[model samples]
Target: MSVAFIDSHMVEKFVENSQAFDKCIEERFNMLDMNQDGVLSRDELQNDANDSSFVELALQSKEEVDSLYDVLFEKFDTEKKGGLNRNEFGLLMKEVMLAKAHGFGETPVCVIFQEDSLLRRVV
Candidate 1:
């Protein structure tokens, strides 16, 4: 079908796809937000996920991921509030997906799942 032939409903289908993605993202954000304070700190981020050392996540060196948290915290915390909000968390998730999709690097199990499917399913 031509783009002109499509209607609002067709476009809405794409919007609807994001519902699941938003849910998943929110769930993850909640998981990361241990205090229910609606944001992530360096210590909070480091402790979540598996029992593995900080190095196990995203397959990066402890120095890399550790440093990344500092960078990520600075970057994602656009408000400079010292933590990541849900939107910021989603951005981080997208970054992980894109990096893995392009074979740029490895990721943690939570992020390593069928990323393409998750990305498309999200939006």
Candidate 2:
């Protein structure tokens, strides 16, 4: 049987326990920052065997992961910046986590490119 990708109740509980989620995100961020770079690049942040830890915790796809880099380059590149800086990086990470969390499910969440909206059945 295919495992359900996300648990809505768990997410609700996660939101209810905001502090816990914050801490979890903080720790997850640290773990994602391999090589001690303090910032995550597309290559560094992309899902891989080495970084499969997030696979079990979050439901994601290769396309979504790749698209994230594209979105980051498109939106957060204020000042025509070539890449994300520390602040931009942090915001990007937060948004990604939120989007992912919002989209968690058995099937990959369809991300609406127009407003970057997430479409899913929460209830």
Candidate 3:
């Protein structure tokens, strides 16, 4: 992991550059597609999702965590299908990044992001 200073402005600039943002999203989606298939199954997403200390820190209890995941999965599965296609994954990622950016608004935070992490790539 590497420490980086990040804030809303920097993230907003990255998102505003559509070409770069799309490229980054594509890269991240590909990485998350664990079975080498173009579609991402709920299981695939949950595999990586299990390690989110950030979410655990914010939520008060296990029930909250489970409920949040359920809600998120339902939201991401826009087609009502069991899996997320590239476009759906892209949309979900864009929203997630933007939300993160909004949370960091005007406040620079020191974060330790994994080398291959999306946040690290964004920075």
lDDT at 52, model 1 = 36
- Pairs that collide in candidate 2 are none
The residue-by-residue lDDT of candidate 1 on 77-123, one tens digit each, is 88898878888887776666555444522231223223323333422
- The full ranking of all candidates by TM-score, starting with the best, is 3, 1, 2
| Top of the candidates by lDDT | 3
Query: lDDT scores for all predictions?
Result: 0.59, 0.50, 0.80
Candidate 3 error regions (>4 Å): 52-63
lDDT for each residue of candidate 3 in 51-90, tens digit (9 for 90 to 100) = 6635553555767766766787698888777788888888
Q: How accurate locally is residue 56 in candidate 3, as Cα lDDT from 0 to 100?
A: 52
lDDT of 2 by residue, 1-123 (tens): 122234534445554565665555456556656766655555555632234334432465767756766776788756454544555655664565556566665444333231211212221
Clashing pairs in 3: none
Worst 10 residues of 2 by lDDT: 114-123
Estimated TM-score for each candidate = 0.60, 0.45, 0.83
Rank the candidate models, highest lDDT first: 3, 1, 2
88 Cα displacement, candidate 3 (Å)? 1.0
lDDT of 1 at 97: 50
